[model samples]
Target: MDADTLRAILDAQAMQQQKAFDAQAMQRQMRHQKTLDAVMERMERMFSAMGATPAGAPASTAEFVTNSLSTRLPEFTYDPDSGCRFDVWYNRYEDIIANDGSTLDDAAKARLIVSKLDAATYARFTNHILPKKTFDVSLDETVKILKELFGHNTSVFARRYAYLRTQRNDETIRDYTGLVNRHREMAEFNDVTPEQMKCLVWICGLANPEDADIRVRDLRKMENNPQTTLKELSAEIQQFVDTRCQALRKPAIINTVWYVSQRRPHWAKDCDFANKTCHDCKRVGHKKGYCKNFTSKKKPIPKQKRRSANNVVTARPKLLPPLVSLKSANNTEINVRGHFNCNFNIDGHEGRGNCHEADTTSLLGLDWIAQDEPLFRRLTKGAICNVSASKLNTLRTSLTKQLQKQFVTVFAPGLGRCVKSKAHLALKPDAKPVFGKARPVPYAALPRISQEIDRLVAADVLSPIDHSDWAAPIVVVQKISPTLRRLLYWTERRTQATPAPTSNA
Candidate 1:
């Protein structure tokens, strides 16, 4: 192209780029204004609720009002059915509004901020963000929101603790651990209450009085301070713990709780407390949620794991499937009830199936069915079996039966029929291969036998012979069964009936 033409093209491209950049800048500017507008709106609504103005109001009155409201809001939480919001109002001319020609008034901003908090976010902020250990609808609106989302239970917190156990590198656990320490300090020196102290100890697994002695000192220090009230101290400690806990890497630890709440079609009343017991109160009927005494000096138990120096060990978050009750589309109960091991039909045959069963160490031997020797030995010695996608159901069943049978025979005799020992029960030194199906018999004909051999090898009944990448041309498969013996015998006869190839000179 000519120099003049190239200059003109470059100029046009530059103009287009500048235009795009200007548009993005404008959009960003608009968004920033919107956020500021939302905050101002909240301030305004709060001011209005207090019957005062943000600016030009008596400085003393504004101070007194904001301080009082901050304290009262914790106790003056709005009922979900009340449709009441703790409003903060702002004067338009006094604050920075957007230049977007939209009337960025206080009401609009408040709505935007409130709207930004969707159901899930609101639930999280309510249940988890609050500082108190117990579930209280009467707490500060924000605190209530977090509690409502996370709920009062060890389940969510327990899973979080389990997740922290997986981080082998100390740094990951250290981040959260450090936050907890800070909260411990603040609660100790500020407004830590008996209830809050108990909850903190329980959640962090620092329940023992000896373990919590350090935290208890901080609480005593806070109580000695003449300035702080129970409300102020509670909020501070709550904020302190929540802030540190937020730094945790496993955000999804609580996400399962969120998912169960959203997708599972049941209210709080439907939850079953039968299987759980509170570590604090030691009550039989009530779980952690209804526990009145929050104070329990329990230190979190550290999980043990074998790891390399460079490896990061984190906790395994336990996943408990939500209780599912079937109901018709019309909201009628579907009467879905049965014992765990009711008759379940498998392959057109009635068989017993129990979803819940305990594992025994005896059946742990059968797990080596598909592992290399070293890996198998590692698992058996540790008595730890990694659940595989293929064998999970079978393994669960085998372990359950073995445990039940052993318990009955050893602990409670005459409870059930005892298993008779046989030669197969005695494990051999090379017992690993004995568990799996035997290798197939080999074929005589080269090309004809290759086809049959291909099937068995593909099915994993036969491993490669002498590390050859491809199947051997004239290999024979061993260990014939009656069913396969008949098919292979017929195949050999058919191949024999055909004449052999002869070379001509």
Candidate 2:
């Protein structure tokens, strides 16, 4: 068997044997006491057989007078009924019993019986007396017995006396002082220093040992801690030692809900004290948090925006990759046809309205006549006939009347066709109808709209792009400009209708 297992088995057997021996001894003592009581009773019966009066029984007057007499009988009268005769007999009897009682008492009789008991029984009885839960004997009596038994000196007695006195108080400090003082006179006693004594007291605070005198062996524990200081040694000293110090033997990693003394297991692995050198982000005497190497290694790298493959960036793309793919797919078959101008030369048609030219410089200029070939083709196909010039003019007039009717309903008065500016025109016309100049609004009658718009924007009355700054100054006008209000309202509505950026993206 392994040494530890064998040791454990031996310990368990020894404990069982000790317990059995204690129980057997107690039983033997009880039996022995019963036997002693029986012997005492037999002796009392023997005394009764000899006509001795029982103790505390009333005696005759003659017996009282003769009770103190010598054992030698004096010459006496022979009257059987006389009190003197009974007294003479009783007095002689008492002296003989007194001499015999000395031999009968166990303390006196033990000298004779001591030779009869076997060595094993005697040894067991002597060695293992029943344990005393409390010490009924006085300290002085204990000292006297110690002196008689062990021949220990006065210093030991004095130390014991001091220890007992201190033990009577609450057990906080271990009585290391008392143990040292007791053996001071002895050549072999190695006294503890004051610092070591303080360390012991600090250990006592952590230990909470039972209210008993501390022993010399327990004070020897302080020798293990060479670095413990008097000021630093407190209950917290154990925590510091368990956490910070490296020792000859490995300490058990303990878990408790009380203040954590040790670092976590993972942290302990990285601990310098455990490894004896810093393994993680190595530096002397410390692990990562306090490591100089770690601090130096963490030099910041300056961030630079990575150059793109195209090396071009406008505004950040609002479209997703999948959306861009879908747009590309839909635009694959783009038509690049250009526009050409057309003229509507009129013939006889009474309902044909007079054509008016528009100013070429204005953004809404419409002097050149245009036609939609797709619409004309659809009209001729629906009629199932090719149109002659007069007939075509009549049809064209009818279509123009229809378009004008719809346009008047949709647009405000004095606002001409909403056409693209000449800068935006895609075609150079070959042939087109010409007309007289269209009338313009007088300059005097024009509102200072652009100046008013600038003033409104500068006052923080108008939003830059989004009308979302509610805290800005409110737009106030003496009289409402319907055109300007309409324009601003439509812009605000359209801006709000568009989707906002995805917050997560």
Candidate 3:
């Protein structure tokens, strides 16, 4: 009983101690697993709310991750008077934190919220809660303090209700409804259903009595029909308003030209001047009886005779050359010198004889003797007046060479005479000269203007002056070509003057 019993007892005690240790370790493992599961569930909920895939799924591609991270979060700076809503801020903050798919601790989130607070709010927190180490405060404690300090005030609800009571004429139906809804939320009034309250507010808020009555009738119809929603009613009301506005608009006028001749036969008699002609004066639009130049009386003058030696009459002025006539049945004959190859058909008739140049008088029925003298002389100038194509080509070549030598001086694209002429402004006896203010050149056109100025200077088209008695501002006009701008010297102010006396007094 001495050695064996003692050793057995020690071994049993040791085994019991080991079992207790194992049980404690197993309990700890279970607790750790529960904590891990809870965290995973929270993460899943946050990801779902943010429309992001769960962590267990494959990681998003690089582009997807980049787009998600690059999105800007809505910034909210706290206002003391309108104090930020805790729930709204928390939701936004949580989403922004989740954008990077990383977890943030409560302390870090609290610090971020404090950082966004306005100076007054931050001061209030520091003064009321933690003056020293304010950021060290927990998120839950900060949130609670903020809610108590800046949460909905009873006075705000009263003000909202007062605003709803007073309706404005210019306010739209949508805005009026929104205002009512906002107040209703703050007041937390549960006396009537939301839809009923909205309808009542809408009817009351309408400035026009007729519009209110119509809306009330529509609401009654909606009440009878359970499926119709308030949103649909609002849309219908907006549509009616738009249609009424269109109806109130003035209609466009259309002008049409009507033919009176087709409408009535009497129209021709009314517009008789159109076809009437004057017979006495040999003109249009009047009869012979109305001719102003016609005379009823006639007078005669005496004639003188020619006499001898010193008073002898000279020969009469030379008469014009007689027109030559040719007979043809099917074709017209044109004779230039001895050539008669220029015969052409005329009124389905043909000629049978060869005509000389002297035999043919009129050219295409135009009588050179009776026609303009200068034109006739030009038509009959040189002996070889009708030159061949080869001779004409030689003349053209010589003329082109001469033109090329003087092209720049003759064909400059500007006011050619204006360049040599100095502008003279006529002024009234008492009028004073006006010096115009110089306009600034635009930044985009500076380079182009500089280049144009340089070109003008080089061509001696423009020159700089040290001073002048009169100065006019330059106006730059843009052209179709981007490189070119038309610069004009505005002289309206300088040239315009008072009217002079119409007649010498």
The prediction achieving the highest TM-score against the true structure is 3
After superposition, which runs of candidate 3 have C-alpha atoms over 4 Å from their true positions?
1-75, 80-88, 91-102, 153-166, 190-505
lDDT of each: 0.45, 0.42, 0.59
**What lDDT tens digits, residue by residue, belong to model 2 across residues 198-285?**
5555445543353222333233334445455666444444454455447545779987686655665556556546545567766555
Whole-structure CA lDDT of model 2: 0.42
**Tens-place lDDT digits, model 1, residues 138-197:** 324533354344332223323233333333454567776775553343223355355544
User: lDDT per residue, candidate 3, 202-256, as tens digits?
Assistant: 6556657667756555556555653445686678788877888899999899888
| lDDT-better candidate, 2 vs 3 | 3
Q: What lDDT score goes with residue 445 in model 2?
A: 31
Q: Estimate each model's TM-score.
A: 0.15, 0.12, 0.23
Top model number, lDDT: 3
Order the candidates by TM-score, highest first: 3, 1, 2
Between candidates 1 and 2, the lDDT winner: 1
